[model samples]
Target chain A: MNRFKKGHISVAVVCAVLGFMISLQFRISMEQKASLPYQRLEELSSRLLDVERERDKLQEKLSALEEAAEKGEANSLSDQKASEILRQRAGLVAMEGPGVIVLIDDSRLKSKAGDNQNLYIIHDDDLLRVVNELRAAGAEVISINGQRIIATSEIRCAGPTLSVNNVRSAPPYEIHAIGDAATLENALKMRGGVMETLAVWGIQLEIQASENVEVPAYKGTTQYQYAKPAGGGAS
Target chain B: MISAVCGLIIGLVLGAFCPLIIPVAYSKLFSVALLACLDSVFGGYRSVLEDKFDNTIFISGFFTNALLAAFLVYVGDHLSIDLYYVALLTFGFRIFQNLAIIRRYFLKKH
Candidate 1:
């Protein structure tokens, strides 16, 4: 009887261990499923889409309110005009007018006689120089490959590709600037200008003046965390 | 058999209530250990049916097999090779073989 009881106890202990392990494994797998990186990314993107939709709805409502206020009170007209000017300066409104489109592409031709192959590829610095020249020529709004050039926007190289406003853009960069087309084109194509520098490196450059050019509003939020109105009383 | 069932139920309840958390890095170790424990249990069951069950061997084998399997997984990870699959296959095969023996023993008796 004692031998039979001992054997049963041993079996019971082993079974307990097995049961514990199985339950632990199931729980750990459940935890891992909850913490997957792809799952988190999916959740965040859905939230971002919802936030973007809310922002668009708010913007439409603001426009409607502004239009109604403009018709109701003449005193509120100045306030609405001031807000419009601020939005335009902040790159919040899509602007369209006479401008210039500069198309820069990586050279397809192989290096000829003692030329470095690296120079044929368009670099971030080249794009920055072109943008600087445009801004210097009084270009009001600028965009590179559909990414609006806001004050906080960054353009840099990201391993074989270029990042404009943190968005990857390959060769054949289309830089559009909304302003005086004649001045912008002249600034880029002048002797010893951006065009000449690019041509020397075997980079392709095409500058065209357009009668009407649309520069999209900056899609990223422009929330200021530190900086406030000069007096700091909430203007 | 009734005692074993009761133990399993108690273990399951304990596991459910226990707040112990295993890191994601040691999940592979846990899996190999589980397989090793399962193989040991099956082996114990077969030995019991054959009237050759040794309590000391069963208890020692249960812990040692689980530890050795986890050690193998750790070493395999350090070597950047998947040796857990080999351990898994061997242990899995043994469990099935032991189960077959236990089934036949019961079948012949009844």
Candidate 2:
């Protein structure tokens, strides 16, 4: 009886600790499921989308006004050519040329237990780095998973997926660029370059050079809210 | 038994509100350790019912089993092995077995 009573004290202590751990794990998993920062990000992202839509409508109106000016004040042939070149440079027109198509996917290695599963997944920075390398290699126009890269476009993380110009896309990210195909492919495959770095994590990358790769036009708005023409009458 | 139940309830409430910041990496280890503790408690309870309880063994088993389970998980993480499942299965099976024995003992006594 005495031994049993003594054992109860030890049992009570162990039970207390067990209960504590159970509750603690429960709270932590719950907190992760509905974190405050994640909630805030979702709210802000929706608001950004709404504002982008508003900006798109304004852009259309501004383009209509520009068209009217072109018709009323007959512009010279050289001026029209220059404006067309500018539109192409601004990624407003779809571009097609000989370039490379890079297909990058998550690491093929089986994620170990208790290891950070995020390490095996593709990240926004990986896509950003690949885009930057392509640009440096003289890519004329680039599109990631059909979303064109623009001057004002943002490539960022939105939870498990990547948000490019406020549009979410998942992996196996396919990047298409229109430029000198050889140079683009060489840039990615350079020693210690983006491809090699990604290979460290077993991220699969396949670069295929094609004679005709289509880069779509930037569909997002480019309305400048604050900045105007520097000379005030350049147009 | 009553003190054990009351202590468990109080501990659960206290832990829930304690605001302890556990790292995301160690959450898995914590779960394995918790399972080990649970297994130890059930085993100890069974021994007490059998009238063969040993206080020293109970105390030591509780700590060692929890630590060993957590260690296995940690090693598994480093070695890229799923040894966590091994610890999980072992403790999970032990918990049920102990419960079954305790249930049989109660029935026999009655």
Candidate 3:
């Protein structure tokens, strides 16, 4: 009986530990499912697609170079034109066209007692959502407070300020997009869109359509170390 | 058996209400460790049924198995190799073996 008692007690203790580990793991996986880090994975996969497209472009450029060599013509003028167009597409060159200017600022409404204060602040997510909406509406070029939004650009929060392409800026964020002005404005003002959600929090948002909206050139370095063009150019 | 079931129930409740929040990044490691713990519990239970249970062995095996599984996951992540699958398959096989033996013993008794 005493021997049975010893074995039984040890088994119980082990079972308790097993139960604890199971529940803890369940909680962690549940939390992961509910969180926003999945967006980071989506961003990285999109970046991979962008690199693949760049690889395709380089392949086309290689074919063009070979044809120029066969013709024995100095294609420097056309090469210059090709590079200029590439730079403009890469957001390295400043752009100007008819589009809409959006201004979003933190809410001025005072938070009631026991309310979470973060709801009233303009977050990086808010800016990202607006930029995504504009892109979906076929915006050709976009910038935030003169900082161009390129493929590799990032909008991240850093304490009281937000960093777009590593340049820190605060609200009221001035977002300029050069596309069809009416389309961009309509995208922002769509019912149940990002603007409506922000309005619920009393965030200040204003949109103005104009004949000319100038978006500045990207100032950051466009160098990449790990990702290489597949198949054709170099290794 | 009753004590074991009660202990498991108590432990589950305690864990559910606990405020510890492990980051999602390390959830894979924790999951492997949990599997190891589960295997240990089943092994201990089987030993008890077979009259071969040892307190020192059961307790040490419980800690060592869980720690080693977690360590394997950590090393696998750093080396970019999926080594936890090894621990997973081994522990998984042992758990089923123990469960089969326990089921046979209960069937014979009835």
Task: List model 1 lDDT by residue over A16-48, tens digit each.
Answer: 888888888888888878778878899999999
What is every candidate's C-alpha DockQ against the true complex, given to 2 decimals? 0.52, 0.48, 0.45
Evaluated on CA atoms against the true complex, candidate 1 attains a DockQ of 0.52
Backbone clashes for every candidate come to: 0, 0, 0
The C-alpha TM-scores of every prediction are: 0.51, 0.50, 0.45
**Per-candidate iRMSD:** 1.2, 1.4, 1.4
> Which stretches of candidate 3 lie above 4 Å from their native place?
A1-78, A230-235, B1-110
Instruction: Please list the C-alpha lDDT of all candidates, in the order they appear.
Output: 0.89, 0.90, 0.89
- Cα error, candidate 3, residue A186 (Å): 0.5
- Candidate No. with top TM-score: 1
What value of lDDT does candidate 2 attain over all alpha carbons? Answer: 0.90
Complex DockQ, candidate 2: 0.48
Q: Model 3 over residues A35-142: C-alpha lDDT tens digits?
A: 667888899999999999999999999998898889877577778998999999999999899999999999999988999999999999999999999999999999
**Model 1: residues with Cα > 4 Å off, grouped in runs:** A1-8, A34-56, A59-235
* lDDT by residue for model 2 (A2-70), tens: 977776776777778878888998899899987988999999999999999999999998998788787
Prediction RMSDs, each to the true structure: 16.3, 16.4, 17.0
Stronger candidate by TM-score (1 vs 2): 1
